[model samples]
Target: MNLLSDSRCGSEEEVRCLLVLPDINILSHSGVSHTVFWLLGIPGLEDQHMWISIPFFISYVIALLGNSLIIFVILTKQSLHGPMYLFLCMLAGADIVLSTSTVPQMLAVFWVHVAEISLDRCITQLFFNYSTFISESGILLVMAFDRYIAICYPLRYSSILTNSLIGKIGVAIFLRSYGTIIPIILLLKRLTFCKSNILTNATCKYIVLAPVSCDDIRINIWYGFFVLMSTVVLDIVLILHAVFRIPSQDVRHKALNTCGSHVYVIILFYGPGIFTTHTQRFEHHIAPHIHILLSNVCVPIPISEAIKTQALLS
Candidate 1:
């Protein structure tokens, strides 16, 4: 029998689910419930799990310390109070959220072999994971615009991106990031898993979880495409235009020096996601465990805000 769990059910952490695929002649109680999932850490590499966790732990430390230091320095030092640093501060916070939501579960899975996750917690982590990821991208987009104004229109940059304006932009970007996640959550409420609760990825991601649903997920897929189209794609196009429009040789060098780290971080941030997305969409011949491990690669997601923070400060 195939089990299906609803993602709703407030105040309940356990998955009280029903059987799915009624057409397959499976019969069960008809009601709404949740599901529990376990992350199957690199199936064949079970013996090496401890060794694998060493690097994960190290990178987690680097991300935490690096971003925390950036946030601390920016907050304590009034000298570093500017639009660029402020945006870096925002990115740092998002990085902390993203990594925290993801790494602890992974560490648990690796260290103690505890991969069990309640559907509620999974969705909650899913919310933070994706919202932070998208918000980071949006923050970077705004950073690109901030750089554009700073380089292309130096004199007007201050007047245009005032503290008030920057705060508003930050709020707007955050709202936009979170608002986009609602559709996904609502969609999840309607889905029930027909597949085994054992998930391939350590983290509960929409991209990972959506495929296991027993319902028609076309709407979810299309809306996701819409979100990517309106936000990520548009941001990339505008950011590229903004970054490339340098007028003089000195100004060109100045822009590169100032914004190079931001661009590099963006590439590092998006590269693995792109590769994983394409691989998931295009290649099915690869082994499932291999695909799962590769998906976690994330181009090695030690997103060092330190570089960007140092560059902006320097």
Candidate 2:
């Protein structure tokens, strides 16, 4: 009975959908959503559509090489086994996970034109993508706290930010991020996707999937906002507090220098997140390839900096 239902669900899904495969016209939900149109108005770069995929492919290559070097540097260097480098290693891991979750599938569609995505695969991609994204958020928050104690409370830094303490915090961040995902997944599970299974992008984003549902998704949207807000608010508070406690004029600059790279990272990370969260309409501005490339491929900056920091420490 279950197998029969599953098979029937696959075939009957699209006809039942109102939004994703709306009754308006045949071209309504067929090809990629017209995210490309908005890119045409970008000043002098309007004619660079073909070059968009070129940069995306180049970025994929950089992320692969840079993240691999991060892993290698952390593993091979003996003197780099401190709390800071440990967090760097974890950050590198998150970058690799994030890139792996997004890049190959994107390249497949760009190169081979394979656009169909099954429901199960869509959910799987969402799981990996969100998991890495949240984990990175949580880790960045903890990293901020780590820097806080190191610079502001230097006298007790060793005792306060001990090896065991770092381990416990790492585990807590992972749990907080990974555990928060359960409710979102459960929400998705309950949704009846009565639309085209063929996703427009290379992979599924929960927001993208929500429009296809015959069921009301207010709860899912609110919960997602709650999760995003908590991560952003908490991280910002920690970062601000860390900034406030700088010791002296000379060291203030040094302290800010230490966190500058991460500050850039948080801005880049959360900018798209805000875009994705509030305005689904803005998502149509960039080519899907450009969006994935900027968000996932730009991850190498953190990875490279983490490796360099670890090497200097060693």
Candidate 3:
């Protein structure tokens, strides 16, 4: 039974075939089976897809334009060449990558009824989606530290956070982001996804795809959880701790003022993220479409907020 021999298996009926294939050996025997996964875009809402796609289209456009402008302004303007603006540029770049990673595929699933994704493309998307997210979290933490030094120790700000230091921090952020994610991809590639390849969302996510495999996914789940806690949660804790260390009210206010945009960006990025993670774990009764909607909504908020924040700062 060569799964790849049939055209229907590569198209609309892929999920049905995947669900019906009972034997793992049958899938693995040919060495070419199960190369594609079917993405279910907002399951149970096939009729309302046009309406649902409107918001996604608008959000993607706004995010792309807004983040691009931020990057452009930061790069072209000589006056904006500082540690703070450099971090914002990195954030904007991450937002662009993150948004681009998911939105186009989502649009294809929504508008063209194209839901089948090859494993390689799916894994590539998954890698960029997560690596950019981890990078964004790291950049936010660096921005917080930048604010801390600027306000808490204004005299030593330039001496401590020099361009060389900022460059080193940027490299560290890239290493930290990509280093943690490479193992997840390796783990994913090792799994044999002989079970149903129907993903509940329009885009590929680690949590969504990990369960479709017949092999054990406990390590993937645990490591993903660890990365979330160590990066974003720890960053939030350290940022708050630093904010409280300023003894004087005026200094505290100033520090917080500088961090206000970043704080809002953090809230916008992580608030829905935490909610979605909890819902996925504890609220299994929730409709799959709701998960898709929440995931889509969460990606664009940071770019929108970044644009607003940069406007105010300028």
Q: Which residue window of length 10 is worst by lDDT in model 1?
A: 2-11
TM-score of each: 0.82, 0.74, 0.86
By lDDT, the best candidate is: 3
Best by TM-score: 3
Pull out the clashing pairs in model 1: 15-34
TM-score of 3: 0.86
lDDT of 1 by residue, 157-256 (tens): 8899999999899999989988998788888878876555656666676777877776688888778778766766667776766666766778777766
Give the alpha carbon lDDT tens digit for every residue of 89-130 in model 3.
Answer: 898888889989988998888788677788899999999988
lDDT of 3 at 140: 87
Q: How many pairs of residues in model 1 come into backbone collision?
A: 1
Query: What is each predicted model's overall lDDT from 0 to 1?
Result: 0.71, 0.61, 0.78
lDDT of 3 at 65: 89
**Cα lDDT of model 2 by residue, 212-285, tens digit:** 66678889988988987777666766676677577686666765666555565676766765664465633456
Model 3 clash pairs are none
lDDT of 3: 0.78
Ranking by TM-score: 3, 1, 2
